[model samples]
Structure formats: C-alpha cells, structure tokens
Target: MAIAALQHLTDPRLAGRIVLKIGSSLLVDGAGCARADWLRSIAGEIADLRAGGQEVVIVSSGAIALGAAKLGLDKGGRATLADAQAAASVGQIALASLWSRSLGTHGLTAAQLLLTLEDLEDRRRYLNAASTLARLLENGAVPVINENDSVATQEIRFGDNDRLAARVAQAARADAVLLLSDVDGLFDRNPAEAGARLVPVVQGIDQSIRAMADGGSASGLGSGGMVSKLQAAEIAERAGIALAIVNGTHRAPIARAAGEGQGTLFLPRRRDGARKAWLGGRLRVKGVVRVDGGCAAALAEGGSVLAAGITAVEGAFERGDLVEIRDPADGALARGLAEYRAEECRALIGRRSAEQAAVLGYAPRAAVVHRDHMVML
Candidate 1:
C-alpha cells in the first residue's frame, strides 16, 4: 500500500528522471507557430531542474500545427492523412529549431528523436532506442521525442504523442510524467461545458472517469482531447509511472506541478524500474514460450525460468531478444529476456543448465533466462 502511495509523489522526483509531454495547443503562440517566450521559460525551468541534478525528456506535439501555419493550410478543418503527414514533415524541422534556440539560452542542447510504433515494437530497436534516450539523459542533454509523423503509415502510428510519452517514461525508467495542455487538468466533464469541475487526484482508472473524457477533435491547432489524456495516464499507471496533467498557460508549469502540486496527479499501483516496467507492460510479444504451472509459480515468486519448465517455444529469434513466457494451462504468465537462442532453446527443452555442455558440446551460461532480465506479467 505504501508503494502505491509513493506513486502520487509526496516529495518531488526532481533529482530523479521525468518525461514531459507538451501538446500542440500549449506550444502555439497567437501567431499560430512556436512561442519563443513560452519555450524560453520552459527551457529555463528545465535548466533549473537539470542544475538540481534532474534528468528530463520532452515529448512535444506541435509539428503539424507549425507546418499548417507556415504553409497557409486551412487552420479550422481536418487534413487528409497525407496532408497531415506532409505538414508534420515540414514543421518538425522548424519546431526543433525553435526548441534548439530556446535551450541554447540555458547552455543546454536538445536532441531531436523522431519515432514511430515500429521503433518500439522490435526487440533490437526497442533496446537501441532506450539506450539512446538513456545516454542523452546521462549526458545532461534534453531529448525531444516526437512521432515520426512524416513517414509513419496508418498501421504503424501512435495516434497521439501522449501515449508515446507514457512509453517514453517507461523506456527512460522515469519517476514521473508531466502532460502539459491548454487546460489545467481533467475535469468532471468538459470544463467549457457548464457544471464541470476539476478533479484534483486520481487513485485509479475507473469507468466513471472514462465517461468524462471528450473526443479527439482539435480546437484549430491541437489534436488530442481528454480521451487521449486518460489513455496516456492509463499507460503510465500500468507501467508504474506517475502522471501529472497541468495547464501550460503559465510559465514553468512543470516545475510548479512538481513543487506546488498544481496539477491532477494519477498514481501508479507499483514501483518498477525501466526494464521490468517495459517487459511487464509491453502490449505485443514476438513469440511465446509455454511452461508448466510449477514454473509459473516459481516466476511469480521471483524465481528464474529454468530449462526444464519450458514445454514449447514458438517463433524465430536469437538470444538477448524478448519472448513471452506462459503457463501451458492458462496461457500468458510473464515475459523475459531470453538467454538461449530460439533454436537452441527448442533443442534444450526439458534439459537442465548443467546438461548444456553434454547437449551442445559447449558449456553455456547458467540460466535459461535470468530473473534480473525478466518481468512477471
């Protein structure tokens, strides 16, 4: 229970890591492009956090908006998928330039990373992307992540950057996620509608809260709505990452949210490091390995999956890849970092670690899969 309580952030995770998402609505100036003063203020706040030893990554959504403004496209109407993608292609450069200039004022560098769902889906790419983001944070540079809007097709899209930010938080092993928007936080209903009120704290996700969310219709310059925000929160919560939704109208809202509790915070059910959280929360798996009920219990109780437990292995993959671990009777049990190559794992089924030398004629590593690299589903 205390671990669950820890999710709400009694003390700021300032010195810890965080992923901050800025919506298109929050980044646009009256002229309908990136706001320099607002960005400068945000960069200053981030600078302050970094000075205090905090690591931060920003997931910003404003490329399409800026692109539309620059190209003189219809500001109030929907764009075809092609139209939107083209705008994003042109806008991302300008957006990054603006952010770079602002961050330069604080003597900090911002690295632009454009990603799509494809990047997070493959094992090697997932590891590589996570490594890149981690190195940037460790080097004290702010990583600016955005949807690879220009090249992504329908099948590989992250519909909103909010959910992507949540995944980024998990990938970065961040302690918190801050979502900046035009409004302050989630309201009982649309705040623009009468009788709506802001709900300050959310303990868990429920249908009552889900019912209050609006649709994805953008108000001219922004794309996400309350629904995307809630979805993003759910993703973060499931990964044991705390989320805060705050108004971006004020300068340094992120710092204020962390220090003054000015935003609506959604707490997580548990605390997990990045690798475990990602392994546990991944929605898709490349392959499945079924084990007996005994093996499932061992894993649930914090034991490593042994070779004897593996009954079946499906899919073609190499060692150091991600594979799903399941109970033969009940199906999905957990996911782990595979130690043996897929073909080798199949050949070694029902064999012990000590038997590796006899079976393969070469002494192998001790574990079929190690607990340190695994997460129970």
Candidate 2:
C-alpha cells in the first residue's frame, strides 16, 4: 500500500487541476532578487503540463523579498508591518512582470490575483474568487496568485502562502497541491540532526507528525517553514486534496516531483468521507438557534431552517458565520452558515420570510440556514 501511494505521487497525469506553491527561498536569490532562470524553467514545466491537458495555478511568494531587496531592507532585520506592506507594494509589480514574461515565452497568459485572509473567510468573497479562477482556467490562463500584503496587517494576514495555497486548492477544487521548498521532502527529524530519515508517505497528520516539523523558517526571505507546510497539508487533506512537498532547486521540479517520487506525499481521505468529517468536526460554533420540533424533523429530512420555525437565538454571530441549530429541548441538531446576523435573526424569529424586508429593511435570503450549507449532526 505504501509503495502504491508513492507511485501515485509519481504519476503526473493523476490530477487534472494542480496548485503549485513556490517558496520565496526558491524563487529569490540570497540578494533578494527574482531568480529568472528558475522562473523560466518552472514556466517551461507549466507549459508542458498545459500541453498534456492539465490546468495549473501558481501560488508564489517573493513580493516581500524582492520589495525588501529593492528598498535596502534586506539586512536580515525584522520588518514592521508598514515596511513589509511598502515592500510588497513595490515588489508586486516586478513579481507579476517576471511571471508574465516567463509564461509568455511559451505563449501563455498569466493572470495576477492578490488576496487576503478575509477573501476566503467571507462566503460571498470566497465564491467570487472561485468563480473568477474557474473562468481563468476555462480560458486557458494561468492564475498567478499572491497575498495582498500591501493592505494586510498582522491581525488580518495569512502569515504564509502555504496556508493560502491550501485555501486556494479548496476554492479551486484542485486535485493536488505541490509545495516546492528548499528541502527534498519531510524528514522524521531535522535533516541536520544525526540519523534523520525521510517520510515518503503520510496517511494522516497527528501530534507525532507535527513534532517532526522545525519551527524556524526555511530562509530569511520567506515566512513559512515545515510547520506551516504541515498546517497546509492538514487543510488540504480535509478537502480531500493530495499534498506533496519537494525540493525546488532542481530543474522542472513539478514534473520531477510528480514523476520521480522525489517528495513526501500526503494521502487524502475519500472525498465524501472528508466532507462529512469536515461538517461534523470540532469547529467553534459562534451562535445557537433553538427551533421547534417541526424544524428539527425537517432538518433531519435534509431541509433548511426557516425563520418561522426558530423559537430563540443565542450568542452573537454575523452572516456566513458557523452556527449550531438546536431543538426546543436545547439538544444540538445541525450546523450551518447563518444567512442573517444575530440581531437580524432575533428580529425575524418566528416571522414569515415575507416579513423579513419589513423588519430588516432588506430581504437578502429566505432561509435562515440554507439547506445547501447545513449539515446534520
């Protein structure tokens, strides 16, 4: 089984939709400039993948590094949020131009997308992003994605592109995620340590697996390290997407990683099983709604929760926030995204959908918790 899993990692044709995450350390030189030769080689690999009828998305990290270098802030010092943002603003243009020129050599168009954490957290924005990427893919354009660091503060930042790539994979419904890093693959311990061994296949992530990751960043120019990569793997696994971590210094790293088994492959759970697990997982429930017995029964029958059937609302929550549905007896029945804010939910409780506009001044949706968003416990 382990050998088969390794072979699956080496099969470049296994996935139709692929998300490649390039670390800053691999894309930037020690002097903090874009590695043009490396970019061109990777672009050539992408061209080959497209020729083979595969769609590719690139989640790259180098704006900050390039920006820092351009601004003379590459002296190995910690940069403030303002400095980082300034650097990102200056470097994003160069980064986009490099990717555009590299891919254009093979007659491919590169579409640049800048995103923040909120873009994926808000349901509406998430759908918008997904739709835009889908259209780009349909038109045969490679989406070159990067964090919106110019506007992101520490409180609202993704902190690393590794986690952002995982979110992108989920949003794009990618079949696999490839993380190109400085190391060859995941090691049982720090490779610098004596007797460290490579872990070729990972079926699950646990405390033991997490302990293997080093806390330090891979390079001075990058924010993520093995820890963030493991976090990314966990996110991808939950979405039933396979993730592979491999060395990026080699030529045609993507093809080699997929066709030579030169990395650690994290196996994904079955798609349906993963979805069910995600729905029932220990998500922080922000609010609770107590519904009538009729609504509880309807929920069990895969129906949405109607405002007229809700008897009470508890806790504060905004629209698109995860909330729990409970029976009149206060027993949990299901969980779903709230269509209305807590205050609006209070005003609309026990009211018909027609009365929503009168009470809230806007009738955005008819159901309090849409059936498509709700999951039975």
Candidate 3:
C-alpha cells in the first residue's frame, strides 16, 4: 500500500515494512564494478520512502560480481565455488562502501549484514538476525543484507538473493517484498518470443503461472531467473507477504512497481502472525512432545503445552530448538520452540514444579512449549 506493495489493490493497505531484492546486474556489470549513478538513484528512492514513514530492508547481490572483477575472473566463464567465495570476500567490502556512500549522499545511514541460509534456519540465529534488523530499523538505519558467500558452501547456500530476501522479510516482519530484476515482470511467455506479454498480477503461484516461467534463467549478471522470482513469491505468500518483480533497469522502478499493472504483484491470501509464519516455514524440527487427550483438547483451545500435560519427549533438542507437539494418538498437532532442553523436558514429564524441584533439586520451566511460540501444523 504505502509505496512498495500493490497500490492496485481495491483497498490500499499500509505495508509499512518492505524488503527489496536487488540483483547483481542491477548493482554491477559483468566486469563486477559498482554502477554508481544507478545505485545513487536507488538510495534516493529509499530516502524518499523513509521520509514517508516506510522502513526498508535490502537484500543486495553484487559482492561476488565485483569481487570477480577484482580477482580478474573471466567474464565469459563460470567461477568455481572457491573462486566465487574469494571474490565475495574482496567485493563485500567494496559493496558495503558503495552502499554507504550512496545512501550517505542522501543523508541516510547504511548497515550491512552477511548471512547464510543456515542462519535463517536455526531458530536462535534467526531470532538474533531478526533482532539486529529490528534495532537497526528502530534507529532509522537502512540494512543492506546479502548471502554470506565468503563462508557458505553449496550445501548451505541460498543460491540466489530472491529467496534470501523472502526469508529476511519474514524475519523482519515485512509486509511486502520487492525483487528488482532486468525484466518488467513475469510474462505469459518468453518475452523474447513474439506476442509475449507481461502478467501484471499473479493471484497465486499455481501450475500455469509456474509453467510461464519454465525457460526463465538468470538475467544480466544475476544467478537467478524468473523461476527464482516465482520461488521467492511462494515464500512471501506463505508469510502473508506480497511480492513484486519489477524492471529495476528503468527509472523509478520502485514507484513503477507501485503503479497499476506495472509489475507482477503476487498477493498473499492473508496476513499471518510473524512467529507462526516463521515456525511454519521451518523445514526441520529437532524434537517431538506427546501430550495426553486433555492436553490436546486444551491446546486445540489455544492453550500452551504445559509440563504436567506432556506424556513423552522424543528426540534430542536443546532449549530454544524447534519441536513438534503431538497428541495421544501420536498425530502431529503443532510445532514450536522448546523452552527446555530435551533432557530437562524428559525429567519434567507429568511433574509439577515443586515435584520437579524435589526430584531434580530445582524447579523447572512451566511449559514444554509456549503457545506464543507455536503454530498449528
């Protein structure tokens, strides 16, 4: 609603927080040098949004590209993982300096954060990252985030900034995500083909929509294509966040995306709780807690999973790790952050605090998993 989300919606919604995913090509060239003027324009746009009371987070790609140039990597050949990481190691500093200078020119402060997909996957690290972003926003500093290419391996890498931006949006509790690309947006067919037309609005990422992106690959110097944009849209949709893919190569691309039918706007079905959204998006659960019928009924009524209600603790999980809550029938009910370590939880089974204290020489935490940190599976 404000300036980055879908302004075309029948009712304009106030999407206060937004995350912008800028591809490598938009930031640099195949030679990996910074695109100074274009970056400044973007910085100015960000400043305008901030003046209008909007908080922005950026997931920028270009470190590797710039680094490649610094390292003298071939423009025509693919860089190896080590080469890419090495390039990122050198370029990250330049990338940060570029953003800092650009944003500073507009009287805005820039904060940089390097992250890996694993960072977002781990509950503790995710919370830490989220907290850092929140504090930066609170202080009116625009955060420029990127994948930790210098340290991450192929097994743990996000592969592209698009999905990374979506995950960051969820962590930052953003209402919208904007992916700036070379193309205007998703087209009905390959834009190179005759009669190809842009799809202004995507209601949802269905089979037909995905099929439209079949041949899409990375554009410019970016490593991702239209398929990556769709994947990002899917992630945003899960968290009730709207996503837009717009042509950043043009003037006022952000403003253009806000205009009707100017970009592909992927709408969310509805807004979901930030914690629930994060919980549901997690692909791994460290443990399972089984509760009795009464506990299951209470949980269904929106109650927490209390220590006295838990019948069994399965799996080895540390405190603050992800866990699954199950019923007497062993059916999955919900997922949450564990308040106690698996060992501690096992010791607290069916015991009151006083009883736990008598047996273990200390009182234990009240719940196996707090309702506030849980989401129904």
Candidate 4:
C-alpha cells in the first residue's frame, strides 16, 4: 500500500503558510563557503511562492559550517562547543547578509530570528515568537530563523533544525512543512543497497517506519540524519501539519517539491483535532472558570469564551497559563490558554467586553479565551 502511494505521490494544493527547512549541506560546500548560486536559486523560488501569495518561513542550518570555514576550523575534526559557538557568532552575520542580499535581488526582505529551545517551551515566549512571525509575514517579509547557537549550551539546544522546523510550523500554524535535504524521500532500505525503494506517502508513523531510518547525518556539514527527520515528522503530525522531505540539491528544488511532488509526503493525522488534542494533553491545568448555561451552550457551538459569559474564576493562574472552563454545575466544558491573568479574570466576570475598561483599569482583549486557543471537550 505504501509503495503504491509512492507511485502517485503529488503535491497537494498547498496555500497560505509554509515552513521550509534547509539542511547545512545544501547551503555550504566542502570548503565551508556558502553556495552562492544555490542560494540565489532558492531565493528565486521563495520569491515565486510569495508572488503567488504564499507566506514562506525558512529554518536554515549553515551558520556553524560557514563560520567553521571562515575561522579555519574546517580541517576535518569535531569542533568543541566553544569552537561551535564562536563560529556561529561569526557565521550568523555572514549568513544573514547572504540571505538578505540574495532575496533583495528579487525585491524581498529577509528578517533574522535567532531562537533557543526556551523560546518555544515557555508559553509566554511561544506566543511572542508566533506573533513576531505573523507580523513579519503580514508585512511582506520572509523570516530566516536559526537556532541561537552562540549562547546555547548542549542541554538547552534543540540539536537539530528538523525538530525546530516542526515547532516553527506549529507556532506559525503553517499549512505545510518542506524539509530540503540530500535525499529525495524516505526509503524502505538504504538507497545504496540493491532493490531499495522510496516510500512516498506515510499516513502514520510507527515502529517499522522508524526502523527504516539510519542514524547518521546525510552530509558532514549537517547534524541531523534521517532519524531526526522522522522525529520531526512525528512532531509535525501532532500539530496536524503536512510534512515533505525532498532532495534540495537540484535547481529550483522548492518549486519542484511544491509542483512536481519531488519528495515523500507525510499526511497529517487529524487536521485541527490533532493540534487541539496535543495542546490540551500537554499543558497542566492551572485554574478554572465557571460559566452560565448560555455560555456553556456557546462553547459547545465552538464560540470563544468571553468575559460576559464567565460567572466565576478560581485559582491563581497567570496570563498564558492553561485553564479549564466549567459549566455552572462544575462540569468541564473546555480548556484554553488564558489571555488574562486570574486576578484580571475575577474583576471582569459577568461584565460585557465593552465594559471591561470601566470594570478594570484596561481592556486588551474582549475574549477571555480566543477560539483558536481553546480546545473543546
């Protein structure tokens, strides 16, 4: 069944947001210098996507490789953490400049975002990062994201851009994730072996699927191998995001991946439901809000939880904390990330959203929990 799916693998009609992860090997040569021609070709592809009204976010790896080349550390030895950090600092500047220049030729602006694991793990920081990416896309700029390797220790680092790309897809609510790597797609066995074949469409990831992945980087310049990409697929799957792995060595690889379906596609398990399940299951419930019968009905109809609908707020939860919503009878209706702190919610219960300013000192949002942030039980 999987082999049959491979024969007909074609790109789905991907619209709106897309996250493209570029491996270090695709961006740097053996000498560790940025591949100028390849970068230009990719920039052209991104420009085409944007021209067609698609928002593109790039999670790129190459700063360390580029830095290593520049600092004479590319002499074929494993670099120390300090050496890696120093190289990242120098390479990041060159990387940003290269991307900026490449995209600039096509009249596109590139914005650099250096992130660490903590940025996505912390709820408040996650929202901030999401908002920033949204704003960049809204303003017609492409975000070039990279791990903050300069200050990141081994314990705090994401260790691979494959997983980082998946997290970015969740944060941006991207429609699709494209991993540009050395290989065309996932195979049942090593491609170098005789009779090895591509497995193009994966509906679900299982132990057998995972067993297919060999644990070594595709190129010396990259740290993530097939295993990391599969792990990334699982993360993306939980967020209900489609993921594709494509060979990025070809010219206009992004265009080919999107149009010709030149890669393996991992279909999402359950669109919105998967994301809601992941969100609700992962967070700790810090508080509860009780609402009237009318509000309960509204929640059931998939409406946002408003201040006027809330009758009472319990427990001490801060903004961005996960909280539960309950009916007047104390039956749990839903759980969502709180927009306002517990004290603020207490002061605004039963008050109309318009009257929030009069009831409290300020009113930033009308809904206590936005529909997008809420998971209905």
Candidate 5:
C-alpha cells in the first residue's frame, strides 16, 4: 500500500515519512532500564509499518535511564554531567542491543545511529544524516537514532529527544513526527490541576499555546514536559510535517498515531512547503533588514530579494539563520529568510548588483535571497 493510504485510513494529513520519538519515561519502568515487553511492542508496531511499505525512523531517549539502572541511581536525585555521561555510555550500548534483539524477533533489522547537535547543525552533516536514514529505509532496515549523551557537553546536547525528533523529521523530509509520552495530549492548563481541559487540536503555535505549558511532571525518566512537546510540534508544523503528542504508555501508540487508532493529532500549516516553513519558523533570528516599497512589491510578485532594495539592517547573523525582511514603507510586507547576511549585504545596500564589486571591493552574489529560497508570506 502507498504511504498515503496509511493517512487516508487513519487521518488524511498523516501519511508519508514518519519519525517516532520514544521518550525515556515510556521506555522504562520505575526501576529503570529498557523494558523488554515494551520494546517488543514497539518493535512489532515498527514491523507492521515496514510490512506496509512505509518508512519509519525511531528517535529513542533512554540511555540515561538505562545507565542509571545499571549504576543504581534513584529517580529524585541529581546526577552530575559526568555521572549522566558514564551511565549513558553503558546504557546506550545496552539500549541499542536490546532494540536489535527485540526487532530481530519480529524479522526486522535495526541500525544504531548516535548523534549530537553538531551532526544536525552543519549542512554537510545534516545532508549526511538525511542520506543515512534514507538508505536505511530503502534497505527495509529501521534506523534507530539517539543522542550521543556520553560525549555531548552542555553546549551541544539536544537536551531532549523532542527537538531531536523534529530535526530528524526535517532532515528525513518526514510527513509526520510522533512524540510518545505519558500525557494523552496537550491541555489548556496543567492536566493535574482540576480546571485543566484537554485541547483536541491546535491550529498554530501562538501565545495562547505557550500559556498552556507546565513543565515536566510524573514521568521523571524524561526531561521534556508539555512545553517541550509543543516546541517540537512547532518545528514539525513549520516544516509542513504533521506532529502528534500522545501517551506512549499504551500498547501501540506509534501505530495508533500512524492512523490505526489513538493520540492527540496536529496538522501542519497549509500555506508553505517544508523548507520555507523552516526558514519562517525560527525561534531566534540573528538580524533584520528593511526593504524599499518597490522591492517589497517585486518580492510579493515572486521576485528575488535584491541588494538594491535594502534600506536598513539590524542584528548580526551569519549565512542561513532565519531573518526578518521588512518593507521600509510598512511592516505589513515583511516576510522571513531573505538569505544574505547582515555584514555581507550591508555594504552592497543601495548599490546595483553590477556596481557591487567596485563598491564592496569584492564580487558579491546577485540576489539578496534567490527566489527559490525566499518564501513570500
């Protein structure tokens, strides 16, 4: 069956490439370590997807819990980064080994891939990561990815698997990302509090959505709470990838999210493709630049962002960071990701592309943002 068939059977918006993010809380029991039966169940669901000819990549988070169990750490205590790393070192091996064994029983193969922030941030590395996952799908082997916690320092840790899952979805060009956790879905307020209500769907990530977040709760095995889950959802939505935050404690949540049954489902924004959405949905921007009225009109007509139309620059950003491109005449014409850097374009501002070399002392690229990269809003 086609991948879209799964979505049509489940939810029309849910087919295509899928990434399942399994958090630590769902992977272990109170005593910690990989839960054998749970792993089996997960593997079985994965096998079903593979049999259906759908691609599935799992972003798993349980190395710390696995290591802690092996080393005997309690739930409430704090572990130094060293302690966490040491535990992850031991746990990651055991975790991958267990998954391999479990999947093997179902006549499936699992490939272990360890990643750090560096692997996703560098363009070459990002492409390499995408290529590796794509190859695994083609071979009918499930690619199981995990953050390399043992060696990751504070600076580059994915912090939680939620963000990691979103990044992976973008890299793999996934149709959806399923984040399996203890909660059934997002709530209007703390679910534990008496007044809270279950929010069936969220159309956009806005201030209203932000108000609903209450940090980590009962499932202490993982670091992310509803807030982080929403953050991950925002990432997926921007990439035109559907996302669902569902309770992982159930027998087959991943399968359910794929459309066989239950979970809190989210639809992607209908307006743009994955690449443009990524460029527009940045949480932090390095800089801002204003454009003249004529430039704004041209951009609205699907023209490239050019140096001659730039009126002002703000902030400092390097190549590829999401930026604000505003119309000097009015802010209404502003869109995101016009491409050229603040420093790089500052000198060429007000000068035609041909005169750019003589004025800036170097031959600069023609368009501030090539038409292909800039998505007009």
Candidate 6:
C-alpha cells in the first residue's frame, strides 16, 4: 500500500491525560548509556506540558541496554535469561537515577514504577496501580514507568514497551498515547526501503496493515518493531484512545505529533465514553452473570443491575474482576466490573438489596454492576 499524505493533526493534546512510550533507540546510545542532554530536552517538553495542565505518563525502555552497556554482556548480541535479568538489575537503578536528575532540573519530580505483566493483568493489582498513578498525577508528579525486567521472566513479560504503553494508557484512562520510535512513523513498507512514505493517519488496522509492519529493531537494543507498535495501536484503538507513532529523535516529538501532525495517528473508536470503551475491550472477562428480562431492559436504558435481577452466575471471579452480562437469547449483553465475588453472587442470586445482606451475611453494594462501570455490548 502506498502511503498517504499527512492529514491535519487532531490535536491529541486537546484534552485529558497522555501516555508517552519512549523507545530504547531514542533514549539509549549505542554504548548503552542514557543521553543526558536529550533527556533534559525531553524533560523541558514535559515541563511545558505539565505547565499547560496536561498530565503525562512515561513508559520508558533501555534498562537492559544500559545494563548491558554497564556490564559489557553483549555476547554475540544475545545473553542468557539470567544474564539479562542481572543486567536489568543494574540498569534499572541507572535509568531511574538519570530520569530523576533530568526531570529534577526542570523542578519536576519523577516517580519510578517498575511493573510486570501481573501488575496490569491481576484485577486487584490493576486497581492498586491505577490508584497510585491517579495519586501521582493529582500531586503533580511525573511517573516514569518501566517493565520489571529484573524479576519478569520472558514468559510473563510485556516484551515491548509499545503495548505496555497502550495498556497503561487504557488503565490510566489517558486521552491519548504516543509511541516515540526511531523512524518517522508507520511507513508503507520497511522504512529503510526506497520510495516508502509515511502514513499520516491510520483509519483502522487490518490484515493488510499488519502486512506493512516492519521487523525487529536494527539496533538490536530494543525488542519492539513496527509490528509491536501496531499491536499497541490496536490496544489503544479498542480503549478509545488515539495513538500516534512519531520519531523520538526530534527536538519536540510530543508537541510535533500532537500539534504539527508529524506522525501516523490511529484514530480512537470514540472518546465520549472512554470508561465504556475500556470495559468493552477487556481481553478477559472472569465471570458471566445471566440477567432477567427486566434487568436487561433497565441496562439497555442505562440503569444499574440489581442482584434481584440476576438469575445465574458462572466463573469464580473476585470482586473488581470484569464480568459478562448475558441473556439467554442475546448471549453477551454487556461487560462490567463486578462488585461481588462469584460465591457471594451465587448466594445473592434472585435476592434483593435487603435479602442480599442476610444471604451473604453482609450488606452488598447497591448495584450488582454499577451503570458507570458497565458498557452495553
């Protein structure tokens, strides 16, 4: 596919929070050290954004690269899992210190958060992480997040910061996500290929779009390629968050991407009901609740689901886990964050608010699934 010309940028910074994923190639040098001057420049941009009342969250890569540089462990450009983890242990401290110092120069406080797949995948931990992020933003602190590579096994890791950024954006309910890459943007073919131009705006990613994805990082420092970025875009798209792929090698990458239309922005599904978007796009629904006709009618009209309306409960989900609301004929009707555990739900089946207290030996929340947390499918 031939790349289309650049369209006018939608001003992704128009409202709400933004997530920025910093690629290794952008932050780390070939010698495996942080680019101090470049970081200061990036921090200046962040300071400017913060002054404008726009919150920013960063998902930065380069721990392993920095570690490898420090340890001189680049054996044929590949290391054992143990060696990689050891490098990460040393690099994480170096990365965090550098981030803190750079942002501090601008009088901005940096909070380092090392996360693994479980932090975002587990319901309880997800909420905890979300709460912490919310508090940091509220207190005017910039969070510098990274994968816990030191402890994260290859099997249980996010491998690339691109998808992690999108997931963080979804969890943080950011209005937009920016993936700063080595190349200019999403190209029609390998960016190194001749006559390959940048695609300004992605309508939606399909198989053909997937075919256009490039291979792994040529620098051999980063794990992500254009393919991982598209996957990230897909995640952001489903979460109703516009995601942009822009070159981070520039001076003001964020400003350029959001204001000057300098990259390929994947348009969001819709921003009007982002909560609903997140709910609907959940990759895993821990349980299913079959609701009666009356409840279904109420839900369709944007009402909450009452315990009295629930006929059956399936799946051993915990409180706060996502669940599917179903009807016999309609199949899955909606998705919601459950207020009660599966066992408690079963005990409260067909019971009203008062009866629920007696059956479960405790007063239940007003709604089985609050309307605010439920999205009609």
lDDT of each: 0.78, 0.83, 0.83, 0.83, 0.75, 0.81
* lDDT (Cα, tens digit) per residue for candidate 2, span 66-143: 888888874422368888898899889989999999999999999999999888766678779989999999999999
Better of 4 and 5 by TM-score: 5
The candidate that wins on lDDT is 2
lDDT of 1 by residue, 335-359 (tens): 8788888888888888877787798
lDDT of 5 by residue, 288-372 (tens): 7788988988988888778898888788877666567778754634345545567877877888878988976767775776777
For model 3 the TM-score comes to 0.74
TM-scores for all predictions: 0.72, 0.75, 0.74, 0.71, 0.78, 0.72
Q: In angstroms, give how far residue 106 of model 3 lies from its true place.
A: 1.0
Candidate 6 lDDT (Cα, 0 to 1): 0.81
* Each candidate's clash count: 0, 0, 2, 0, 0, 0
Candidate 2: stretches off by over 4 Å: 1-13, 74-78, 272-320, 323-377
lDDT of 6 by residue, 32-55 (tens): 878877888888988887777778
- Scored against the true structure, residue 302 in model 6 reaches a CA lDDT of 88
lDDT of 3 by residue, 1-377 (tens): 33233563212246788898999888886566687778878888888888877888999999988888887876512358888888889989999999999989888899999999888997789999999999999998999999999998888888888889989999998888889988888999888899998887777777789899944455557778888788888778868888888889976677766664577888876556766787866655789999999889999999999888999999999988899999988887888999988998898899875687776666666677988888875
| Candidate 4 pairs with clashing backbones | none
lDDT for 230 in candidate 1 is: 86
Clashing pairs in 1: none
- The Cα error of candidate 3 at residue 271, in Å, is 2.9
Task: Provide C-alpha RMSD values for all models, in order.
Answer: 6.1, 6.5, 6.2, 9.3, 4.5, 6.9
Worst 10 residues of 4 by lDDT: 1-10
Model 2 per-residue lDDT at 34: 81
lDDT of 6 at 6: 25
